[model samples]
Target chain A: MERNLHYLKGSFLKDRLFANNFIITLLFVLLALAPLFLSDFRTNLLGKFIAYAILALGIDLIWGYTGILSLGHGVYFGLGAYCMAMYLKLEASNGKLPDFMSWSGQKVLPWFWKPFVYAPVAIILSVLVPAILALIIGYLTFKNRIKGVYFSILTQALSIIFVVLFVGQQAYTGGTNGITNFKTIFGFPLSSSSTKVTLYYVALGFLILAFLFCRWIVQSRFGKVLIAIRDSENRARFSGYNPAIYKTFVYCISAGLAGLAGALFVPQVGIISPAEMGIVPSVEMVIWVAIGGRGTLVGAVIGAILVNSLKSMVSEGFPAAWSYFIGISFVAVVIFMPYGLAGLLNQIKRKIYTQKSVKQYSSAALNILEESGCDEYVG
Target chain B: MLDAICGRVKPAEGKIIFKGIKDVTEMSEHQIVELGIGRKFQVPSVFMGITIYENMELAAARKRSLYSTLFTKLSKEQMERIQDVLQKIGLYEKRYRTPAALSHGEKQWLEIGMLLVQQPEIMLLDEPVAGMGRKETDKTGRLLKEISEKCSVIVVEHDMEFVREYADKVTVLHEGRLLDEGNMHEIQENPKVMEVYLGRGGEGCD
Candidate 1:
């Protein structure tokens, strides 16, 4: 009996040592440790990656699990960034109207811009605007059952239209230039190292929170319905889950997260532009999710970091070849990883655990039954 | 059973007053399913992406949130219930295999396993043995007979042999209307059923 207890404890310890949980917590610890040793530039780069990860996770919630591949996620991100930028722009002007409008010969700030001049309202509006847009779009599209590639095309069109409008509207939106060269965020100078570090950690905190939030959502009952829709949408409908409601909820959540990420991003990146909200940039975010593993949270983070960090290195090292690298990598990950890097890791983890548990459990259980003299009862 | 078991195919029309005042429009399809009104499609609607076990787990996982499903391990009791249902349908060996790899007969059995796990108050199976082989059809008939002992089962099938073997009661649907409802013998010999089943374009062997 004592021997059996020891074996069980040993197996329990063994399981904990290499569990998916252990790995995830370890990675988080590593991320926390990174900034301590890394320089400001690298820390800022990591912050940028975390922001991108947030976007990818939101997209994955909509596109990967819910099977609603949206092209308008960039618009959500843009909305958040624009809101944060509006506040920054307002603060930079020091209670006066912004320079661009002053240069363009405007006497007063627009009524719509007046509300956003306040930080709290801008943040609320930033998240709300995208959610409201997504809710409407999701309602119209999903109710009509406009699925497959058609949905993708419609979203892509939205992205193009948003970019065009943002670009063309120069006076109100800052047009092609966008609201940039921000001197302050909530009265704190961006030039200060402490502020930069604080913002970096803020971005990191938000990213971690987003990851945990998504992780919870994906593991919830609502998440099973999502996978059901993904696996077989028709089945989910007949089973009594309104696919539209699930789709709408997840899409809004995705939009809200993207908007939140954008809000965080603007402070760190210090700009919001039509260029960043364009068709290609939005599609590139999708690529990050695809290459990382769409269904897995960590995959989103890893893919963002790996791709962006590589891009940073390549831009400095090889410049123009970066696009070629991105293109080839996208195709390679799609064709080879099919499940993505996280999926590959999951497969390895499963095999290891399955082998270990099957062997250890059967022996332990059999011995327990034999000792207890209840083998028949166990069967 | 016959009037309560009337021709209303749309579950949205289900009206059951409990103590006379609470509206259950908020009750979802899965809630209705859990409340014992099991539904199967006209065509088999298996989760084609997963294994027979995982498909059952997906239904079982409905009881859990996405986070619990992703993080928490399935308890032994849950695994046992899944295994028992699979074994009842003789698909225990194929539990680990994907639905795409399953044969039409196995797919039917898999659906039955899914229903068995759910153990609904009423089982609504549509064309349960539509594309199944003779032996597999016999196995399905036996499975249904076993399932019928516990709940009210309504099967929508064109196979006269399957209905005759398993149905305690039969309802014939023609042009989205319930043409006739009775016991298997009554439905088999009723002039209206004969005329409808044998008379409906003679496309099927009566």
Candidate 2:
């Protein structure tokens, strides 16, 4: 009888895992086939949203799993987008000064922008710059044990600082007007429908890879330590785990993911600006993870797509009402769905699983009572 | 005092020599933990966000460096050690559950199990049985006694009966100053302890 109960428990877990995998597979299929059914413009728009989804995954890692809220991920994303933008801008200039540089009265391309002329260099720097920035910030803050809301406020300050710095640098960074008028990437026209489709697929592919990578990370023992740090830093410290090291490492990785997202976003969107990486957009990235579900990786992806799609759709007709709509929904999500959509789904799944198991256990107990004459003991 | 030993609180004066080499006061919390000292708080503090098994796994991990933790999986022996500790603490059945699901006494045992997996040379427990009932307190006393055979356990408690029953040696403090130090019988006879702690008249605590 005990063995039978154990077998039932084993199968119950297997069933839940299977259901989760099936849902994920279905979502991936829908996303993969979206371009086939949608127009080029819509598909390109999705590619941009997918980039934001990648950024959302990073936020979920730092905020949801590790419990370190970063309100300045936009800086990382902006830096990455700017890196890619610099490369494209240089390519479009055709061995001459970029339009913004010439307009700002710069005679020659800056030494810093020279390296970005190479596609490989630009791509590497896009990811590295943000990670290094995060490393510096994380190392300083975490080592000093600055955390919780203080850390969040610091990140907000970072975003504001970056926006100011970017806007003030007219000659090198294109200033308030920002970098635009991209002609081609890798000898292919940016406006071509075929290029748009390819970039969309590329963005989708990266999203999947990033999702799987993050999923693997959170499942590992290191992931457990991350959660442990979130729960109690003192307990984790006494367990011989350095909370600072783990926090800093995860922060750097999260920043890198944001940077990668930004790199992908610029090509699809065809614009990069200081406004995009300011405090507002950074906070918006966090909302996506919150509304999707914080700790769940899949939830981050869904939340990003779901929220952005809603924004695009709602803003089309009632542009003035878009912020109000998002504001209301975010407040509602915080109050009612603290765990977000994924957490709500999980709660429902657990409810069903428990009910089913309780029924099975009762029936098994009835069989035992009948066979062993235990009914006499049951009053 | 326990916090100072664990490097949670820095000492303003004097040194805390561990194994006659390392000064715990000079180290950070994790560094102190690495130097063979494990501390349990008055409250049973376990990682409530993760499974009991994971809490054990994190403690059992030999190399606490970032790279090792990221890349390495627990060996079979480490897995066996975690299982053994879990069974010893009577939490084997609930290993997959989070600490929130455990009873108060069970959470205390799980925290002990976490320290057990680490096998530190010295275990510092501040009121290990602070909120436990008599039965649970006795059980914890027995567990600590058994654990003491492997490593030295320094426990702070106010319960005279518990101290008399379990502690090998007793030290009575009055206002952060040592009033007496001896076995239970020797302590009960001391006039200083009788006056300062037991409330005059040479009468014993109930």
Instruction: State the TM-score of the second chain for every model.
Output: 0.76, 0.94
Model 2 - which docking category?
A: high
Model 1 / residue A218 / CA error / Å: 1.4
Q: The CA-based lDDT of model 1 is what?
A: 0.78
For candidate 2, the per-residue lDDT at A81 reads 96
Top lDDT prediction, candidate number: 2
> Among the candidates, what TM-score does chain A have in each?
0.91, 0.96
Task: State TM-scores per candidate.
Answer: 0.80, 0.96
What's the CA error at residue A299 for candidate 2, in Å?
0.9
Residue A171 miss distance in model 1 (angstroms):
1.3
lDDT tens digits, residue span A1-379, model 2: 7677777778887878877777777888999999999999999988899999999989999999999999999999999999999999999989899998888899987889989989999999999999999999999999999999999999999999999999999999999988999999999999999999999999999999998899889988889999999998889999999999999999998999999999999988989999999999999999999999999888899999999999999999898999999899999999999999988988899999999989988887787777788877654
How well is each residue in A1-379 modelled by candidate 1, as lDDT tens digits? 6567566656654674457567667766777778899898788778878788888889988877877788768999999889888988988888898988887777799888998878899999888888999999988998788998999999989999999998887778898889987998778898777787888888878888988899888765567668779987866654545677778878899999899988988888888898888778888999888888887777787787778888899999998899999999999988989878888888887687778777877877787888889979677
Q: Report the poorest 10 consecutive residues by lDDT, candidate 2 chain B.
A: B197-206
Tens digits of per-residue lDDT for model 1 on B1-206?
22222222334465653225533344545445546566676567788755567777765533443345446766688778888888888877666567888888887777777776766667777778888788988988888889889877777777877777777777788776888888988777788878876776665544
TM-score: model 1, chain A:
0.91
Residue pairs with clashing backbones, model 1: A218-B66, A219-B65, A219-B66, A219-B67, A220-B65, A220-B66, A220-B67, A221-B65, A221-B66, B36-B121
DockQ of each: 0.31, 0.82
CAPRI level of candidate 1: acceptable
